[model samples]
Target: MVSLPSTLERIRTRLILLALFLMPWQTRWIFGTDTLSGGISEFGVLSFFVVEGLIVLAFVLQPFIEHHRDFDGAVTLGWVMMLAMLASVFSASNPHLAMMAWLHVLGAYVLFLNLLNRHVKPKEALFAFTLGLVAPALLGVFQAVTGSSPASTLLGLASHDAMTAGASVIETFSMRWLRAYGSFQHPNVFGGYLAVGLFAVFLFLRWDVSKKARMGAYAVGALLTATLVLTYSRSAWIAFVLSSVLAGWLLFLHHRVELRRVIPLGLIILFVMGFTATLFSNPYVVALEETHPGREVYAYQPVHNLYLLMLSELGVIGTLFVLLWMVLIDRYIFANLPRVGAVGALAIGSALFIIGFFDHYLWSLWPGLALVAFVLAMTLRLSEPGVEKE
Candidate 1:
């Protein structure tokens, strides 16, 4: 998108932003699936989604875009990851599943590279993302308030009956309600999206934009925060809260000498999480599994933890490389991203890492994968130094 003439580049930026704005819609075409319950499991299906098509278009355009060579570390890590995923296919429990997973991983890696190379501004990226959240957030709020989820093929919603065995719902002693799913396949997915959406809006508000823009961000943030609660996704709730605290902490300690304090806090948080997981593995696994249609070990479920899921998918060597990749990315040049933007990016990255400890969707599911890539590219770009005065 960057190599075009100035006028053309501007148009292309609009188009790319449009793609980001529409990327969350779940519309797709299914090619095939593995038989589960005499039908294709949604997870096992080979489908080409609308978002995937947009990503493919961007991928195809990537070679033509001009790039700065400042991101050798990120680029090298991407290639290493692609290689690892390609290798993992042979050893995966299901070859077809593995290939599909690899394909999405490749997409995510490509998307991350594309965004960073093209140089989308932090505010622009945040604006596009939060704008995209509007429709889904509104729909989610409606679903939560009415306790109904009407089917709409075009909108990517399926009718959700709380009484259905496979439906996601909240049950109290006297009443039960369907958890809002928006256009996502599950409430946790919806909540996860909203959690980040809220963060995006929060950051957008902090920028010195027009009053009207700030008002819009406030409205969207409120919607996202309210609907996030309705989804009742504990993982998403924790992710949002931790992200807020991390952001505030990073901002407070942006100085290099003070940044070291993050290490101990991070270590303590990890130790507590690890201990809690170990102490409650039995009931925690049960609760995690019961959130969806139950899965037997034969059918298999990705471990609730993202790190464990990565270890399983990528093996020890691959996982080690992935960890190294993350470290390398953090070392990428902090270009023109404003100080606040950079701190916000770092905080969100930490949040994602923490969420990974409790959820696998960012690695195991398509929507989760794409959304992570989206946020990650923004974070990567924002990490670059931008200390411009308003």
Candidate 2:
């Protein structure tokens, strides 16, 4: 023996923690280009990511550590959705681009479902997640205060000038203030992450951690909040405020909800995902960037609504699978309302859904997908067996 750990389990554990921490933080990615623009257009496509690599590695090693087991029913449903997404690409203008996008989706879904089935402890997972956010908060604050963002290829950062045409900024009579991007593609995406991930700080409070940890949580919360405000993303702000208020009301003030009560939310999201199929849309919208070559298509914007975005890209067949996935997940959580983590999960999902109403990132962007994956994994804790009811 080389004196290494006897099993791959130890390596798997460390990889899991590292992946969780990095998944929600700033991503380190590089895009290879065959074009003159040096691949800005292929930012998401033809991209290699550090976190995605780690997740795939961990997933590959997973079978070695466990005994033969039946497929997790919930995870299987996610796979079905993935298959539908693939099937939807049959008619895409650029099926290759669609394939890459589908891979990104699969990575996110795998991350979500795998974390749900794992046996990680709450305190450890929470700490890894909450701390993962601190660096982004600090960097975002600096960018906002200075109104300058420097590019670093190694760090996967791109320069942002407040005076630039496409730069996200706040314009007032006094000056055009720069918004914090926080290593994300957009300020809104950054704000979305903070709004949802900031709750992890509070969730950790439930555990009896040390004084230092408690103070640290308070500090992290403050930092994230500062950056969130600087991002000036109204959608994120609304999502956070509304989700907190509603979850608090339903979880504490209201009586325990039965499964019947949660059914409507599922229908709502399902309806939204399929709603675009009922309306007319641009024929080439599904793979616009790839379909138009040698064009500055970054200026193009997708539909702001997540539902509309999904319907446009995924087609009716794919949208239906996603809707079914939502229905099943909703019914499951709602059935357990007032149980361990049901309300908390619902609140986070609601916040995300609300953000989708005003922003299309959760369905379109890689960073946004990573944000969802991290939150879903973290929040799945509440749904675990034996979580005490409030």
Best by lDDT: 1
Q: Write the per-residue lDDT of candidate 2 for residues 1-390, one digit (tens) a residue.
A: 643433565566667678777765444554543332344463334575788888778667663333112225555677888988888777776666677778889888866755654445555665676677777778887887788888876666778987888888765434556788887778998889888766665555555568886666666766677677777687887898788767767755554343333333324433532442232232122324345556553333456888888998888888988888766666666777765366777777778878988888887777788777766655555655554321
The true-versus-predicted C-alpha distance at residue 270 of model 1, in Å, is 26
- How do all models score by TM-score? 0.81, 0.80
Worst 10 residues of 2 by lDDT: 276-285
**Cα shift from native, residue 381, model 2 (Å):** 2.8
Q: Per-residue lDDT for 240-290 in model 1, tens only?
A: 777777676656655444344333333443454354344322333344455
